[model samples]
Each structure stands twice: as C-alpha cells, then as structure tokens.
Target: MVHLSRMCTLVALLVALAGCASAPEPQGNSEILNLQAEAEYAYQLALLDQAETLYLEILRSIPNYAPAWFRLGNIYSRTGRLDAAILAFERCVELEPENQKALYNMALVRLKQSHQIISLARRQNGVDPQVQRQIDGLYQALLRLQQHTPTDSN
Candidate 1:
C-alpha cells in the first residue's frame, strides 16, 4: 500500500509538471514582433498576398495568436475566399471568445456567403425550394445577430 501511494504521488507530480511545461511562452520574441510589424504594414499597404503570407507564418509559430487569425480572416475575405475567411475568424473567436471584431467580421463573411449563394442560384435560372429555405434561414440568423449587436454611438 505504501509503494502504491508513492507511485500515485509521483505520477500526479509528473502530470502537473507536464502541464506547466506545455504552457506557451509570452509573445515577446523579437522575431515574432518583427513579423507582426511587417504583417501589419503589408496589410495597411493593401498588399494582401504579402500580408496573408506573413500572418500565416506568425500563426505557424504561435497558433494561439488571435490577432494573426483575425488578420488572416480579413485577407481571405478581401480575396473573395469567404469559406477560408469564416474558418480563420472561427479560429480567432475560439482563441478569444470575447473578440467582438472576430464575431462581427464572421457575420459579414456569412452575409457575403449568402449573397454569393443567391447570385449563383439566380444565374442558374432557378432557386430550389430547399436552397431558398437555407437562404432564408441565413437571413434570419443575420437579422438576429444584427438585433443583438450594439450599434456604435460614435
């Protein structure tokens, strides 16, 4: 019984240490900071391709970097890659649930997606009842989001 107790304590300590060991370091590395600056500069300059590449690189080094994910989502949205934009925004929101920017951007991307779907259906000469139902559902969801979102007083 004594040996068993000792083994359990050792395992518990090791597990705790492992959890601490896996904790991420603060994003204070010079290289990461440099990349962040470059990425922001590129984005501001409207060099979306370069911005996307830099943001992706930052994400690879720091998967929990919510800002990088948010920028990536914006880049994807501007390039008309709505699905990818939604996915990137979703990741950002996952990392920072209180991120109003991510949530708002995601809603915008969803609206764009609905527009594309409707346009495509129109170009095909008819909207399937099922597809129309889905589009209506999307509109309803957007309306709900809008109602709940606080308008800027500024």
Candidate 2:
C-alpha cells in the first residue's frame, strides 16, 4: 500500500511540475526534456552514474528544476551515496514543499541511514560515529517534518 501511494505521488508530482514549471520546461528548453528522458532511460537501465551526470547537466541549465533534483537524489540513494542523496532531496523539497514524493523519499533515505547503523552494531559492538551523527540529523529532520507534515498513512 505504501509503495503504491509513493508511486502515485511521484507520478502526480512529475505531471504537476511538468505543467506548472516556473522557469524550466519543454517549451523553454526542449532539449531539457529530451535530456530528462535520456536520463530516465539510463536510470531504468541501472546506469546510475550516467543518469546522475545527465541530471546534473539538466540542473546546470535549469537550477530550479525540481524533477531533476528529485531524480538525481533517487540515483544517489540507489548508488548508496546517502549524504548526496539527502542534499539533492532537500533541494527538491526546497523548490517544492508540497512534493510528497520527495518527502517520502527523504523518509526512506533516513531509514536507510539508520539501517546502516543497525547493521554496523550487529557486525561490531559499536556503530560508527559518522553514521550515528548522520542518523541523529535525519531523526531531527523527521521530527520537524512530522510537525509540519500530516501523520497520515502517506
């Protein structure tokens, strides 16, 4: 159920952003859309680094483009670059606070951070300080997000 909701939210956000772009768009930069399509294809093919580069190129052309930021974060998360994933997700959220997909993705990444610490604790007697600090930070962000965001099933 949660996965379905996230997928719906992601699709809605993509459609919404594509329609109501503030500065970016298929019209202003037709090539940007083409690049996005190429990036997505690379992503589907599991060519994460290539997709990241393509998304970064799109961002360079349109800094405020939320979809690029969100997609970049997705690639980062899949590639296990947690810090960069969070930053990219944060950028997307900054551009679109109502982006439920980004919000949900942030929560997933934070959970992944904690899972790393849990795995570390199981392997050794203690967790890494850096991982602990990152988990703490993500916890705080989740707390703040809970206040502003509805504690609904989504």
Per-residue alpha-carbon lDDT of model 2 for 66-154, expressed as tens digits?
A: 77788888888887898888998899888877777787888878777766765555455346888667656666665565467542121
After TM-score superposition, the amount by which residue 101's alpha carbon in candidate 2 deviates from its true location, in angstroms, is 1.1
Q: RMSDs, each prediction?
A: 12.0, 9.5
For residues 1-154, what per-residue lDDT tens digits would candidate 1 score against the true structure? 4335334644553453345546864444546667878998999998999999998997787777777788899889889999998999899778767777778888878777776666565456445888777766766666676577653110
- In model 2, pairs of residues that clash are none
Tell me the spans in candidate 2 whose CA falls farther than 4 Å from its real position: 1-28, 123-154
TM-score of each: 0.65, 0.61
lDDT over C-alpha atoms for residue 86 of model 1: 92
Q: Write down the lDDT of every candidate, Cα atoms only.
A: 0.73, 0.73
Model 1, residue 45: distance off in Å is 0.6
Q: What lDDT is obtained when candidate 1 is compared to the true structure? A: 0.73
